[model samples]
Target: MCPEPSTSGVSPPVDAVTGIEAETDHENDAFSDYASDVSDTTSTTSSVRAYVYENGRRYHSYRPGQYLLPNDETEQDRLDMTHHVFSLTLNGDLCKTELDNPQSILDIGTGTGIWAMDIGDAYPSAEVIGTDLSPIQSEWVPPNVQFEVDDATLDWTFPENKFDFIHARTLAGAIQDWPDLVGKCYTHCKAGGQVEISEGRANFFCDDDTLDKSSKTWQWLAEFRKLSEPLGFDIAPRLPDILKAAGFEDVQLTQKHVPLGTWPKDPKLREIGRIFRVQFLEMAIEAYSLALFTRFGNWTSEEVQVLLAMVRTELKSNKIHLYTYTYLNDLKRKAESNDSNDHHSPEKRQNTLTSEAGNDDPGDEITNNLSQDSQFLAASTSGEETLPNLKNPLVSTPSKFLTDFQGRRRFLGPSSTWAYSRHVMGLIRKYLGQHQPLEIPLNTDGTAFALEFPSTKQPGTTITMQDLPSRDYAIYLINTVKFHVCQTYHLFEEQSFMQGFSKLYSEGPQPLNAENKLWYVQYFIVMAFGKALLMRGSSEVNPYGSEYISRAMELLPDVNGLYQDPITSVEICCGLSLYLQSVDHRNTAYVYVSEYLQFYRVLHELICCSLVSPFA
Candidate 1:
């Protein structure tokens, strides 16, 4: 019943970004050789029984070619991330409709069954069913929850007008015949059942209109929009009308701005955008394109990939303020109008995902639902903020999200310096057995109660010459770090870091200036991550990684040991911060992050102004 990730075709797409790969075959390696016989009696309980593969991805086989995206593990993870992003958009509430002791819950197009499982766990008494064309859900689900492989577009065998709640999302590109689908939803949902459908408009929008109409990002989207028209992917704008046409009453239309990256200024919105960045950059860009372009547009996989790479680069560019609108068309907005008095309290409609984990604290202000993910996320923002003043989103955004440290606000961290100092004094008092502590905000990723120790003391050890890897191995590690780490966090200046690497690894240990020494420390820190990624199979303390980090720590001790070169100092600080975050030194990593944000923000502002400034 389980569909495994491809055993091959895992080639990295570096050249894809450059759009220079030679053309070849079109068959996808993931499932090209795998095929299933047509059983006289096909079970609706599993999709692995039958499969269709294309362009290095998998898709639903019920109506094999209808849906444009894949149904593999990669797509499943993106779906979960999408769910988390939206949950955050609603401020911890799963839906706008307050589920009143829901007895029956139905999640349509339940990609990974994450939402269905969470709902099942929350409403123990409710009977929950998640239906999709793929039966990839885990075998172990809540007793009340179950999954079925049913084609939503075809006749659903589910009892009509029986569900108390029905929900669907991210079904933009997969859907065909929108009205019939809504009619079926209305037909199946109980008389007073609440239906929530969220479909983001299939096109991107720039409030500032800075995105050129002729840009690849726009051109590609316009191509997909026109191509997918016959397939009926443009479902967001017509969803409300569809619900109304289906005889659904009290339809409420709520819209959310789904930013494409870390472009929003609001603390929560910035966090949301950050997660979307990863979701789009790593996989969604290709996942959303490969099928539509090749199957419909008759473009070769290589050509589509080339165009997709250009789009990826454009999406990641800093010149645009782009976002898409996701509309929530709920069928029960009028359910609570009878009593204008608010009835849903935090205690009553508490979000269940974090409730059991004890993560929900109203006093904490911001809630990160993604769990060790990005926020700015549902857990990890890029770990290190390139912008120094991340905490001041409103102020920084109006000033074009200043990256410069010049004239930055004094208070930049989650908590102010005065508050941090108070915590320090409180820790000392507590150590002496006499202390009355004031309420302090734990803003550093909520990693610590107080900054007691910088981190566990390290041995005064150094990575000896004998411990260093060969030149080729070192280059491999650096490249691995670049693809895996640098692409995500943007750790350091490419040319400068490469130059440093060349100098340090040259025939002679270049005369050790302060700059050289600091670069040596930074290089070691970067190399540690290379070892960490490769050592995933083993959880034991990696002696080599430990040794590299220890030697770096021995040289620098704290974040950015030297400040002579502010840019290099910020780089050191970011590298250290990411390492600390990886090793569960989150609070310490946060401190490093807070410091670097100030330094990096200014540097970023200077670069952007230099590039785009009219006077320049």
Candidate 2:
């Protein structure tokens, strides 16, 4: 019933695998002996002249540099990485449609045309057409697959109801009007056909309390969103609504939490996190930011680079557990029939809409109770039903509480804090018992314990610690409490501790007083140790340590007048000692510490009326 694909004006399709191999060979042969051919390729052909070349990458000249990123080999690699990520997320399936034999498929905004080629190979009998703005797709492709240079936002010239399946993914930032795009897809898809939309949430989220509002990564995301607002591409949680509004039936939404780094305990998630860190964070962040920040936000390239560097540091840190939600929407077009349709009228359809939030797995049919004039109706059925709400027939009503795949909730129950404390205290006692024998008093939760041991600094003296939990126990308590409290809560704010500090240092300081001076001293102490923690387990020296220490030293004059107080003097000395111990400096650290002690003595004498206050 369908016409064969015409190869009249189009390039002949090459074997898909053979194309990939040829590209790989070209890269290896060209790059092995010399650098990549970064020379201008715009004049290679009249069609290639439509692209703008910059920084060894090609950009779309049709929009006059509207799209910030390049369509070069680097971007192609990142697109492949995204393909892997999507494949893993969907459990090796491209779409959730149950169609036995889809005749025609359309892929919108299909960069690199990899997905289309793969689908073409999988279904040799089907025709797959991949459309994009650039013509950077490989010359070789599957016989049934074809690539065309087309902007998805423009009016599509394809015949009505031509495709059996339509798919669009990762077009969040590229689309200006998503509702219009969905409508176009609905118009082109055949009756009883399916449309699948896949997109990741634009904002970042964290289940653990590790990532807070003040993090550098959060700031970067805030700035990115601000610049992206004018582009009209902020569609994540609202995707399902848009699909349903486009006259599609049987809309289903699935949400998954994708980690940003390799910090998850689960092996599968850990691998995904690693790929995201390397492919997205390290390689693609700059390409995504460079033009947007410069043109839209008026930020200098150097300033953007500095901000991105800080973001990279935060992303690499295991202490920050971050993830973003990826949403998949599956919808179907109604079959043509003579039966009266409930949602045929736009007015009634708009008025009778209902919203239902789903969990990770499929659940019940959310019903909307409305008047007789309302078009929305709830229908529950098995797999045979046209618009079945449940994904699996065996999945019944979901339990009120959320559970993991193993069906066990690994969270703190009632009295969990007490139990955790007891377990930690037991471990501390076992480790510390070998050092000395002493009476250790237990608090109500058995966390606070006191032990007398010879001080490492002052070997002969026995130091008694009271009302303090052991270091290991404290860590366990913090982790347990955070895991329980932050399981459901997600923080989304730009103003935070680090942002405040950045503003203070970048801008001139306010009128310094006693309180403000003490705050500066405390902040310096905290940051020095924070850097130490971030640089742990590294074989090489931490490149950030010297810069951080230098910045902290700039605040030294703020605390100059407080040298008369022994507690203030002791705090500064202790902070300096800890910082000296943290960094691995050959000679610069000793020089800095000696200069600090000399400055402290001079300030002490100035604060005191005479030099005989403490030194004399």
lDDT: worst 10-residue window of model 1: 31-40
Clashes of each: 18, 0
Report, for every candidate in turn, its global Cα lDDT versus the true structure: 0.58, 0.53
Deviation from native of the Cα of residue 532 in model 1, angstroms: 18
lDDT tens digits, residues 450-564, model 2?
Answer: 2111233221221122222222222222232234333432211113323434445345354545445544443444444533232221212232234334444544442445544
What's the lDDT for candidate 2? 0.53
Candidate 2 residues lying further than 4 Å off, grouped into runs, are: 1-45, 54-57, 212-214, 337-616
Looking at model 2, residue 516 earns an lDDT score of 50
Clashing pairs for model 2 are none
Q: In candidate 2, how many Å is residue 313 off?
A: 2.1
